[model samples]
Target: MGIIKLTNIRVYAYHGCLVEEGKIGSDYRVDVSVKANLQPSAGTDNLKDTVDYVHINRIVKEEMAIRSKLLEHVSKRILDRIFNEIPIAEEATVEVSKINPPIGGNVEMVTIEMTLHRHNHKQQSEL
Candidate 1:
């Protein structure tokens, strides 16, 4: 019924397609835009009012820190952890970016963005 947006959350981790890349960790930037009803939190203004952003970052960082074979998997894991750990978030769009990839291309960073909705499909239905 509403929207909550979180942007530019960065985490340093070691996950990549190559071996050395994993050995040498890099910065991972995350931008999460979640859509849900925040009426209760808005009105209550209590600690339990809405989804805790602090805890959300912790979940994302922990999930991203895991050594995954693919950025896609990492993104999905972070997304899943957020939805599972934070019940108030109905749906979330996670953009996971790798700073200065080791590919043979001219780019400062390579980003893998994944969008996932909350369980039961009611979250995306609002959008």
Candidate 2:
């Protein structure tokens, strides 16, 4: 197994519980990591056989564009799409950070992280 990571994807998005936050928006940083079997691609040297980072980046950008009340909601949406769209991805973790969040205090950022495994998703569906 191997992992592909896309880090520090910056975007301007409107995602927060505050009304002012929705209108004014804020800066966000997103990171996504996906695990998959890399032996096939390593041997074949073919893009089709591996988890493509470009595809992953596209997913992050698309999901982050949507408005949500909380970072957790956006993080879950990103994970769900990764598994649904990238069939080769066995597991994925996403971190969504709100830079200079409005929670009051000297905080650098507020981040929400979520991890999902393909098997875990299957089990949830069966339930």
| lDDT scores in order | 0.79, 0.92
Clash totals in order: 0, 0
Off by over 4 Å in 1: 120-127
Residues 1-127 of candidate 2 have per-residue lDDT tens digits of: 9999999999999999999999999999999999999999999999999999999899889988999998998998888888888889999999999999998799999889899999997787689
Error of 2 at 13 (Å): 0.4
State the local distance difference test value for candidate 2: 0.92
Give per-residue lDDT, candidate 2, residue 60. Answer: 88
Per-prediction TM-score: 0.86, 0.96
Task: Using lDDT, give the best candidate's number.
Answer: 2
What lDDT score is found at residue 92 in candidate 1?
A: 85
